[model samples]
Target chain A: MAVDDAVRTALEREVGVEHEELLGEISATLTRRYAAAVGDSDPLYHDAAYAKSLGYANVVAPANFLPGVICWSEGAPYDRLREDGTEADTHLPGVPAKGVRVMGGGEEMHFTRPVVAGTVVSRRTVLLDVTPRDSKQGLMLVARYQDEYVDERGQELLRSVRTVLLR
Target chain B: MTTPSDLRVGSALAAQTNDTSITQVFRYSAATWNTHRIHYDKEYALKEGYPDVLVQSHLHGAFLTKYCTDWAGRAARLTDLSLRVRRFAVAGETLSIAGTVRAVRAGEERRALVDLDLVETRGSDGETCVEASATVEVPRSWIGEGVLP
Candidate 1:
């Protein structure tokens, strides 16, 4: 898609729509797998007793494991993949910004509390905002998505603001 | 509840480097469901004001985590993590993330809280592309645990 067309489509589209993502319960296996992938051997993330001593009833999730918490609800995989064969959402299926490459500019994470094992989480997402930057190359688009994580009782566990830079 | 105090300020920690490749960035984008084109499409990235497919912000943060943990060693838990992307990270750029101890505290129990000034620099330019700060929990006996010994 042309860069201008893509930009217009994103701007005209509804932004800031609230989405309730049922992330289901925390899984020890997933945590262990992530820890292993990251080459982490922290006992608090693997041993229940160690975690309990730290005031956690079960294993704690890794700081970057937020992607595993939600099943991003959106379109098919193939359609969302960019021309270079990379998916759009990074973790879940979502709208395709074919011409644009989204760079995870970084995130501001507020861990209100620890996510213990077996507690189901609900991630609420809001599109937040989209700003366009006209650079020397052409046009740059900044997309920000805000994800709020809550428990069964509606207590905020974590809030993440993810910003991505696209063309 | 342990606050942000109790950590030694002005101390130093070891720095770490990661030889990041386009393939790794592609896989990260795939696994994370990130579909931003600047990450893998060099043509697109160039057209959008970058030299190549830029690294994701979270990936940069991940590099910071590696730098801290490499120095803190095992038995460390990131009690709090906060990062702001100051610039872009392009592909084929080898980034070395390093940190200096900012503060330390007596965290929840047997945990020493630490804060650091995190930085990511490109080998080619020798300039820090991203600057961040994070709070992590390390065991009080971390140095004696053969991690820093």
Candidate 2:
């Protein structure tokens, strides 16, 4: 079977199935580094004292910080990764571990609560659907994944439906 | 200090220019643990038909989020953000982002919900890289005259 067909079939079958992962805690360093990398100098993200002044126990992460992280674990061995450097074991189910080029298409996010440093996070994801369209480059498969990120206590932090384009 | 009184449907937040460098791209990739070669390996990027390393889509999200949060400051909270990547941005490019108020609606507890339309344009060709929208929840006091109508 063509690799593309296999991906499409797998994606279709995987739709509606929920996949969950424990994304670990939101650390002060992770939040700080992410904020710094974005060149954001918001004191609420930098100073614990300032955050406390605002009633937070610790620095507050930028709203999209949790989903912005591509990998929470150490990741797969180099040889086990795709040519594009993405892990074969990514949260994205159905898509082959290799032989596919994947890129983020877009994202829609709703922030339910402010995430402060030290909050443990987990995410539940499910494939929503897939559409095949001819692109200038070639055939492209567009997939959207619904994700709900929750705090350790099961309270929701944010929800997003992100689109990924694959070839 | 922009307060709630400054928001209006036709008003636009100040447009700001963000300059990205190769170093910045590398650092952002490292900070996010993104191992994509298209963002760091210039050779790989060239092979992929891009001139140089490309910017991460989430980085674009960060830029748009920053624009809204900076404008809202302490008076408002960013409740929702959505973005669609229209084009790819290469490293060392200057990106200009501008947001205009789209609508105003009443919120719970004497609050107001402000919707903003945003666009990120490339400085080199003036091409759009991403288009986004955001909703902010603000105290009713932030509403400007005619902003509700």
Best by lDDT: 2
- Candidate 1 residue spans exceeding 4 A from truth: A5-13, A47-55, A67-75, A84-98, B1-11, B19-56, B66-80, B86-94, B101-115, B123-125, B135-149
Q: Highest DockQ, which number?
A: 2
Per-candidate TM-score, first chain only?
0.79, 0.96
lDDT by residue for model 2 over A36-144, one digit each (tens)?
9999999999999999999999999999998898989988898879888988897788888888888999999999999999999999999999999888777789999
Q: Candidate 1, residues A55-80: lDDT per residue as tens digits? A: 78789866666643223344347875
Among incorrect, acceptable, medium and high, the docking class of model 1 is: acceptable
CAPRI tier of model 2: high
C-alpha lDDT (0 to 100) for residue B32 of candidate 2? 91
How high is the CA lDDT of each candidate model?
A: 0.66, 0.91
